[model samples]
Target chain A: MQKVVRMDDMNGVASGFPKTAGAQAVVEITDLSLVYQTADHPVTALANVNLTINKGDFVSFIGPSGCGKTTLMRVVADLEHPTAGTALVNGGSPEQARRDRAYGYVFQAPTLYPWRSVARNVMLPLEIMGLPKADQRERARAALELVGLTGFERKYPWQLSGGMQQRVSIARALSFDPDLLLMDEPFGALDEITRDRLNDELLSLWKKTHKTVIFVTHSISEAVYLSTKIVIMSARPGRIIDIIDSPLPRDRSAETRDSQAFLDVAHRVRQGLLAGHGKDD
Target chain B: MARMIRPPAILTRALPLLFVLAVLAVAWLGGAVWLNAPQIIDRWQRDGKTDYSTGELVTAAWSQERPLLPAPQQIYADLAKSFSGRLDSPRNLLFHTWVTGSAMASGFGLGVLLGGILALGIVHVRTLEKSLMPWVIASQTVPILAIAPMIVVVLGNIGLTGLLPKAVIAMYLCFFPITIGLVKGLRSPDPLQLDLMRTYSASPIQLFWKLRWPAAMPFLFTSLKVAISIALVGAIVGELPTGAQAGLGARLLAGSYYGQTIQIWSALVVSAVLGMGLVGLIGLVERITLRYQAVPKAAGGRG
Candidate 1:
């Protein structure tokens, strides 16, 4: 099922043409590497990783577990520091970008405070940003409405379904209206049906907001369906094995998964993953 | 199949508690009889009464003046007498309760303040966690009974008599639990949540007020329940060493000196009820403050 598309040569850099002609680069990484100094030995999480994500791009970092996909995203978010090289977010250092509130991060779990109501939880980032009280409420309302959680404002996190809770977290991430969104397997914990529904919703939300999203996931079909550019990585001194620029149309729906182009991209992703594992042996 | 009629929820919850209390009351009655019997038998022999039946002896045992162990009813009667008088009078149990309760309230307030500050320091500063935590634990290890008298004597020598000295003793006993609990509570937010806060570029003060403080509420209430009970104990003990007038501890001392077992039991019972009331009050406040947290199970009905 795999198509014979030319793969970008692995020269420690994967640069794709911006979809929109004058789009500026949102994230730029240059030979970035991170080594965790454990008690026994140093564990290499990311090695000589170089990539550029442009504005309005839905980039998915897909790999096996312990492949530094999440670690790479964390490095870009300034949640973790690289031991070597550098990462620039919005043309500034990741730390500076973070201090300017350039991005919002959604963890695998919802991480909503149990004590706060749905609206209040969404307002949390805005509150910390020192937005006016009325502005916080208005923005939270709009964010919740964007995620189709309009009537559930007063409900607590525990009262919502797992899928609904994840949506609320998405709304929370969008509440501050940051230019970048770093999502670490936000729907990884949901069932397959819920995951599929959320994938469609996320695509529409991305189209509406035009935000640059760096999503980390282990699922090949998900990465193929949602992302414009897919970064495939390998473990054991984690590094990118292949970068594929998807040829799928901009607008996607549930029926898009059955198209030949979708299957072709997915098959190439599977091949890239196998190639990464083959190096491990 | 016939439908079974389930009991009301309140009654179902109360049944086990009622059973336990009934068993305790029966055991207490039996203990009173057993302890008072020997003394009553000696009294009968000294009075030269030869034909007293077992039934009469049992009744006499329960009713004797200055009995070794007062019957539950005698203590109840004493409590009734204390309550029937003017509430502000020295003879009233309420008067003594007020004295002890005031000291407990002040001490609990002081303990909460000190504990909150210490917890904030420990959570923020690594040095405080390493250097001061051991000392906080060591302070609790010194028995309150041993130190209460000294605190009272020292504070009294400096002219800080009355409720303040007793409150200091109470504060000393209560602060440890609150400090430990608040520390755990303040740090209760998971790493992911803290990282989320960092992504927002939240300042330390903002993080504390918005995230850490709210997260610590449930833990604070739990520790307060424990702290308040111990504070009452500290206040009562503080009263004992000083022979202070007008407190429950003083009433206990007077009862013991005069061989008034009923009076002693009455004071003990009042103190026990007061402790329960304090804990119950804290629980009520917790329910109100944490109403959003009631549905622990995701499947439960919404608030």
Candidate 2:
């Protein structure tokens, strides 16, 4: 079913962001590696990962478990430090971009404050940013409307279903509208039907705002279905294995899934994942 | 099919309570007969009275000037009389209750505030939680009643008299639970939310006011309920050894010195009411504040 696409989606999300994110690179990483120091042993979460995400790109990072897709997103979001090489967001260090509020991150879990209503959850970032109460309320309403949750603004997070709670978190991430949007397996926990529906809504959102999105997922079909560009990573000393350029049309749908070109990209992703698992054994 | 023979809902609840009250009344009467019987018999023989029956002896046991255990009605009558009299009357339990209530409320208020401050420190600083939590718990282990005289004496010497001294004792009793509950509550936010806060690059104070503090509300109220009850106990204990002036504790002391068992019982009942009122007040506030977040499900797990 076609979800209602709002005229002004995620009002706060695009406020100060470059409208078209269409010129130059939004994210640039070169030979990036991360080593997590544990007491027993140092484990490499990501190694020698190189990529460039342009403005308005919907890039999906797909790999087997233990691959550093999440770690890469965290690097871009400035949540974790890389051990080697350089990662730049909006042409500056990740720390600098984070301070600039250049990006918003959505975790795998909904991460909505249970005590807060849906609108209040969306208002959290704006509250931290010290926006006026009136502006915060306005932006929250617009963001919730973008996610088709206008009527449920006053409902607490627990009162909503899992999918609705996830949408609320999406509204929250976009409440402050940043140039970059990082999602780490946001729909991984949802059932197939809900996931498909959300995938369509997300694509429509991306289409509307043209925000630079870095989505991480395990499903091959999901990556092929949503991404303009697909990044495949390998496990065990996690490293970028291949970068596949998706030939799927911009408006990829159920028909796109049955299309030969879409199947070609999905098969390639599956093979890339199988190769990563092969190295594991 | 035959319909189920379920009792009416009101009857189902009230019947059990009525039965329990009946059993307690019967046991209390039997105890009165057993203990007061000796005295009534002694008087009968001493007066050379003749033809005293079991029924006469039972009726005689009911109205002693100072019975070993006063009947429930005797205590109730004393409470009614004490409550009905003038506000300034020394015999009035309600006035004594107010004297205690002032100290309890003040101490409870101060304790909750201090505990919240200490909890904020404990939650933010890792070393503080390790260093201070042990001491906070240890302070409770040293019974407040045992230390009440010392606190009152030291404060009294320093010119901290009356309500202030009793309030200090209440604070000593009240703060531990608030501190512990708040610490647990402040740290209760899911790790994912913490990471989200980090992503926002939110300042420590911002994080506290928005995330940590609000999340800690339910736990704070729960702890406050417990603390308020104990705070009343602390107020009474503070009054026990200090000057014996104008509190339920003082009333109890006066009654004990003058051999007024009925007076002591009335004081005890009034204090119980005060504790319940304080806890009920907290519960009402909790309901009002947390009204939005109530989910209709039984909490299936502890912690």
Candidate 3:
């Protein structure tokens, strides 16, 4: 198994990423834990988590529903604070990084304002960043075209299908050209066909932009297919159970799903998930 | 074929209302005859004309000098007579309508502005929402009719007469609905939308003008529709207790003093028409404001 996992150019190294000099590791989390105080009892969403995500990596967090995958993403996005330990983005606090517009977030839902046109929705972050109107228009148009929504620029979110809405949202997240993109179950609400198509497009998008993407999802296949590194988590005081770095080649087609290496990785992920469920049972 | 045969959208909306109006006209004419017939017969009997027939009785009732319930035609005729006169003449309905309409318009504008500001504060400040919202709700529960006289007297004591007092009343009545609707509207953005804004490092001001306020447009306009109609009512009500010698309320009072039921009915109808116009004006503004929000229907656009 170790022989099967070939560490290519050492760029895909997870834990030792930051310690290596001059590496462009975008996120560094060390023993980070978050305890949410509910009305009745305190719930631990994440416990003793450590991970390093390099620039241009497609990282996926896969776990059960109550697991802290989304929580971890939220922490990195500066939407939530940790209960203990240090988490940094671009060598600074998440709060400072957020203020610097270091990342774009795509929620589980499309989350586009129904009142805004698609171009206007994509221009939202740009507008907030005080980009001039002409620049906003140009960047927004380019992002929409990248997501295959060029002609739908003037259409409202409600006018688009669910899959199309998600694509528009992706366009919105990319419009400002943030270095890091955080997505929490973005394709969770989509149909299998749409999700599959988006997954392919998202890969292409990642290739073109070379942006670091931290994706949270429940689908094992989705996590395995898209991720260079897959972090498996468990619920009830959620913690990272395993981190499987993909040994698959850089250029992967749909037929890659049937490859022995792909099956081996998927089988390992399934085992990790089953091992997680076994603890609860 | 289907496209050519289909009716205009406006006509489709107007048809039901036109049918209702036709039914109402028939009812109003029938009711006027039924209600005033006996009074007509009694007056004729007093005049030694006891041999009057039912048709004559109805005609006389419809054409009465002072009817119990004025016939619709009489009111229309009175409106025509008043409206056709000089604009400045007291006899002209437009003269009095202008007086009331101006006060209502001023009040509506002020109410919307104040309501929008209050909603902004309430949405931004959780403490204000927790404290001030209950009072706003409580303020509306107090009946306007019961409070109108008191408000009039107090404002009069301060030497604030004429349009100011009426406009204040309009402001009072109109603000609550706008505030409530706006508060709900300004916060209408889903958690995800709000989170997205936060990710962009959007300032509170940007969050409002860009995201929250735009989302609240539909709610704000809906509340304005309710507010404008009531603001007009408020201006008219302000006229009543103050006993001003102008406006629709003043017209009603003068007609009542002379026992001219037709005049009173005409004044009431005129005021209703004015209310519709005010509401229609607001609706037009709302359409212009939200025009850009209309879904693009290009052939290639996704459904």
Candidate 4:
């Protein structure tokens, strides 16, 4: 696996930051487990999950439905609480990190306020953070441009295509310039062609911004294409089965997916998923 | 090739309503003649006039001094007379409308304020939603007609006479829909959207003003349309128990006492017109407020 030296890690290492400070890691999970108390019985959503996501790493959690891939991301976002062990974001508790606005979260749906225009939608978090009007407008403009939605600022969400709306949501998540991004199946609702295009766009965006991302998806190809690290999870008391660090170069294009190394990593991922399913069967 | 000419949108929209009105007018004229003919025939028979044509009987029925059901022309003439006089004159239907309309307006204002407060309380506080919502629902079940007189008498005893009592009754009727609509509206945002707001670390007030309030605009307007019409009804009902000298309710009372059915019909027409005007006003405001919403279908109902 080719290890890329990120800017934050270089700064941490140069500054002699202690390993106990979790300087290089954007997220650290240790034996994390979550149980949902249902009417009939307690359902374990996550089981003894251990993972570390480093700075500027594009991490994808790939698993089937009912898997705790989304749940583990939720724990990092403080949207869900773990029943056992710890999940940390930016060297602090998830709740504290959330309050500090350390991350931007993109949900399954666009979740744009229909009342607000595209620009205003992007500016929402900025507004909540009490950014000045001029600063908000400037940041919103820059963010919209980043997602290739510069001219669509005045248009409403409904006016846009499904793919465009998802892009706008990505712009919104980026508007605040959070150190980390959490995306939960953002392009799952889009058509296949749109999904492929967005996947490429997402990779380029990740490269340009160098922000750590924790993406949850069910598509193995998407996971293999976009991620530097792939976390495979299992269902019915979901747990991590494998973590594959990609050997692909730091820069990749559409042609990269056809390469032998890409297929090898994808094959390993498929095998891991089948192995997880075999345990349940 | 000749281009096909289509009716303007306004005309097309109004055509159905115009057709319905024409049908109603024809039915109303026929009903008037049918209802008044018997009285005319009885009078002619009592006078020992054996030679009477059906056409003459119909003409006499249409022109009766005190017909059971006044003709449309009679009501129109009465309305024209009331409108021609000074607006402040007690005999003018506009004056009565003004008195009732003002009371209704004041009550509607108060109702909106009270409803907004109650909805805010109920939406933000779980205990208020559980404890107060049932009482709020139960409050509406008690018939307004049965309680109007007592309200008037009780308030009169406390030196809150005339407009205040009537306004209170109007407020009582109008507030229920607003509260219910607003409560539903405030809670209408998708759970995912709420989670998005949580991610932003938005305060409770921000969650309301930025998301919930805007989402609830459609519901609030729909409720207002219902509330305004009912507020007018409340104002009239409030007037009935008091027997005060001014207002549509009083006009109906006086007309009945004098057996002037034309006057009664005219007052009823005025009240109907007033209700339409109020609802139309609300529709106008709703359009202006919710212009950003994508489609009218999106705001179709409480959903």
Candidate 5:
């Protein structure tokens, strides 16, 4: 993997978003397991998987629906706890990290508050964390502008198109200046044209911010195009099959997906996914 | 590209309201003529059965009044007199009876507070929702008339005679719609929105104040409009059992007892207008709040 070691060199990732501290592994999962207790049975969602995410790296987890990519993301964000083993953020437990406001998570849906204007929705995390009002406003405005939603601060979520709303969610995730961003199929709901545009925008934002990101997606091409490291997982009680390092250059563009190097990485990811498909059966 | 980016237009919406007003004017004019013809001929026959002259006919048409369908002109004149302080003069028919106004105001206020609290409780607690929701529906199913006397007599015996009794009646009828609307509104947040909040480690208080409260604004206003109308009905019914007060409801009862049709009709009209005005006030607030949520269709911009 082409490691981005210097925070000062990570410019143009986001408009006014601070670079990560870059000295530590921000997220670490050690043999994590997750189970959901239903009425009739307890379903194990994830099993004994270990991974480490360093600061400022763009990493992605790619697998099928039942592969626990989203489950792992949820565990890392402390939205859900692992049934066994443990996960840590910046040397503390996920719960402590959540209390310290260590990360921001964006879902497949935009999920912007319908009543709030785009700017206010972006400011939600800051307000909840009880930041100074002036700082919240400044960060919100900068985040909106970064997402190319500069003129849409006063507009409600429903008034914006789906792609715009997703961008607003991204802007919201960046507004709080969290060290890590956990995204679960953030662009899955968008159409092809919008998805392509957003992928480019997300890459640009990642490059500028240098915030360590763990993105979850099922698309092989998308995984290869965006991430420095791609973790492939097996379905049904998901365990990590392989974590491959991409050879693509750090400075990416729309044409990066079409390049021979990108194609080779995507091919490997697809084969890994296919091989890991029947582990449950 | 031009088709996709259409220019702003206001003409389309205005056309429908214009058509509706025209239709209403036509219907009113036709009804006015039909109502006047019978009374005019009867007046001519009763005054010695002579063939009416043009002047006499015109006078009769203008002057004739029917008990069932009172002339719009007469209602208008009465409305004008009431507003102009002629009717409200102490010597005149419509004095500013503090008794009636006080009772109505108190009753409506009590109803709103009761309904609001019940809704909040129901929204926050599931057990209360399961227990109370069905009973609320069942309460509305029974005729308000059947319940009105029981309320007045029971409360009157308990010495809760004036404000509390009347307010209880109003609340009894008004609470259901408000509770249902508010519950739906409070639960209106999208699943993803809830997850986003959860990711932030937001407490229930934070989630509600930041997300649920604002989302419920539109629904709350809608229920308020419905509740206001019911509150007026409850207040009027509360006045019916005791005609001792100087309210429009007491006026209505007095008119019915003495066979004074015009007085009853005037009181009815007043009640309608008051109810409409109350709902309108809430609607005005709704408009202001929703404008912040609404995007002007003409100015299509991206977020």
Candidate 6:
């Protein structure tokens, strides 16, 4: 099952591939399939997946619980491997890209080390990169400040609320300033109000940094609100069913969420998700 | 809200003190009845003209007419006698026997350090954990009494006398609790926390020191409390096998041999006091260390 979508399918889909339109792709995945060999049996997770993500696109993977969206995100982060696939990041293997610090991964939960304060947690990647002490400190503070966590440097993880902790995790992700930010349900656990606030903050951050983002979420509203392109995946043996181009404007604000265009795109994404459900059956 | 709730100064401030006083009163009353204070006092009056004086009651306990137990007054007097060196002038009881204390101190220190290092290794290396965890559990199964003589004899033959015999014994007893508590502590990091550290790209050493080690503090203190008491037991046990001179263990031995029940009882009290002090010290350090980690705006921010 080598399902592939040509470039025509992604036309005007907000990939912004013009930076190196003629050059080699940043991430090129083909014929990706995954199966985990459990004691009971091999569980087929993903099958016949093919996609190309350019350097600075805001892409959202929207699917149900068993759709393998997170698995795909993990695969891209080099945290998990597909059973059969040709997956590459930045013209290199996923592991090589991970080693070269080309991607920053944010998990569903804000897995901040409770013992380390916010700033220290952010400085961790910098330390691994062997950056100087002063540079680590400056970059950490800058990242924290960018996430609106400026005065919380010395605060431990437990000291913050769930939203604050997630913000800290985002700050830590941004600390290294990687080209690709792989987020797996980063705001899925938060309340609706906090999620909306974080969405705005994320869009502003994304606009400023222009880093490639691959976000996995089960929330339709979140995908519609945040993504330039939304990839809807079918459940069980997950594969992309539809890649919807959101017609909402890029200069988003609170009022933009209430706009008719935003609701129309959200409705379209929901329809795509419903179509995916039919495909699964 | 003002009428329903009392002032913080009046309520929160005085509540704990009142609670503590109530608990102490209950304990004192219970102890008085359980000890049969009136009967003990009558016996003391009756035996007031006997060999042991009223002062001896403080350090050495008495059993009225019986010899099974010493009275509280008798034990108190013995404490004075032991410290005053009046029993045998030149060779004072507590002073000449300070060796036992040094032995216990050295043994406890060595045990804590060794146990701490071993815990780190076991927590990190799965193979070491599989091999060593069983032996740790097995070590506790061997009765200290059954092994004490063998250890003493072996050390004596190797010309390793003095604190070595006792320190080894203390370490044997102390390490198990430390290892068990520390393993749990090191493993206490939530999955979310571990993922965070991984995301930060923290090295193994950094992870241990910054995350696992600090997280293990409360557990460490709990085990240290148990281990310190066991260390004292080990020190005393070390004294028993050799029939050594100086130390509370030796004091217990000598007292039992001469049927000086008061002497043995007083030495036991001293050991208990020492053990309590060590546990208290660990608790104090725990409080200080945990204070810095405490979330200030948390419900109970009194740390």
The DockQ-derived docking category for candidate 5 is acceptable
Query: Which segments of model 2 are wrong by more than 4 Å?
Result: A1-23, B5-62, B298-303
> Over all chains combined, what TM-score does candidate 6 have?
0.84
Q: Which stretches of candidate 3 lie over 4 Å from their true place?
A: A1-23, B1-15, B292-303
Predicted model 3 interface RMSD: 2.3
Off by over 4 Å in 6: A1-24, A278-281, B1-74, B84-97, B196-203, B295-303
Q: What is the DockQ of candidate 6?
A: 0.47
Instruction: Encode model 3's per-residue lDDT on A76-119: one tens digit a residue.
Output: 99999999977889878899999999998999999988878899
Tell me the tens digit of each residue's lDDT in model 2 across A47-79.
877677778889999988888899899999888
Instruction: Compare the candidates by TM-score and give the number of the best one.
Output: 1
Per-residue lDDT of candidate 6, residues B131-162 (tens digit): 98888889899999999999999999989987
CAPRI class of candidate 1: medium
Per-residue accuracy of model 5 over A94-168 as CA lDDT, tens digit each: 889888778888888888777678889999999998999999999999999889999898888878899999999
TM-score to true structure, per model:
0.95, 0.90, 0.92, 0.93, 0.83, 0.84
Alpha carbon deviation, residue A92, candidate 5 (Å): 3.1
Q: Could you tell me how far off, in angstroms, the CA of residue A46 lies in candidate 2 after the best superposition?
A: 1.4
B140: Cα error in model 1, Å: 0.8
lDDT of each: 0.90, 0.87, 0.87, 0.90, 0.78, 0.80
Residue-by-residue lDDT tens digits, candidate 4, B89-196: 998999999999999999999999999999999998999999999988998999999999999999999999979999999999999999999999999999899999
Inter-residue clash pairs, candidate 5: A12-A208, A13-A207, A13-A208, A13-A209, A14-A208
lDDT of 4 by residue, A138-197 (tens): 999999999999898899888898889999999999999998999999999999999999
Task: Output the lDDT of residue A182, model 1.
Answer: 95
Instruction: Tell me the tens digit of each residue's lDDT in model 6 across A179-269.
Output: 8998989998999999999999999999999888999998888898888778889877888887776678788888887999989988888
Q: Note each model's CA RMSD in angstroms.
A: 4.0, 7.1, 4.6, 5.0, 7.2, 5.1
Which residue segments of model 5 deviate by more than 4 Å? A1-24, A39-42, A278-281, B1-66, B81-102, B158-164, B296-303
Q: Candidate 3: which docking quality band? A: medium
Candidate 4 accuracy as lDDT? 0.90
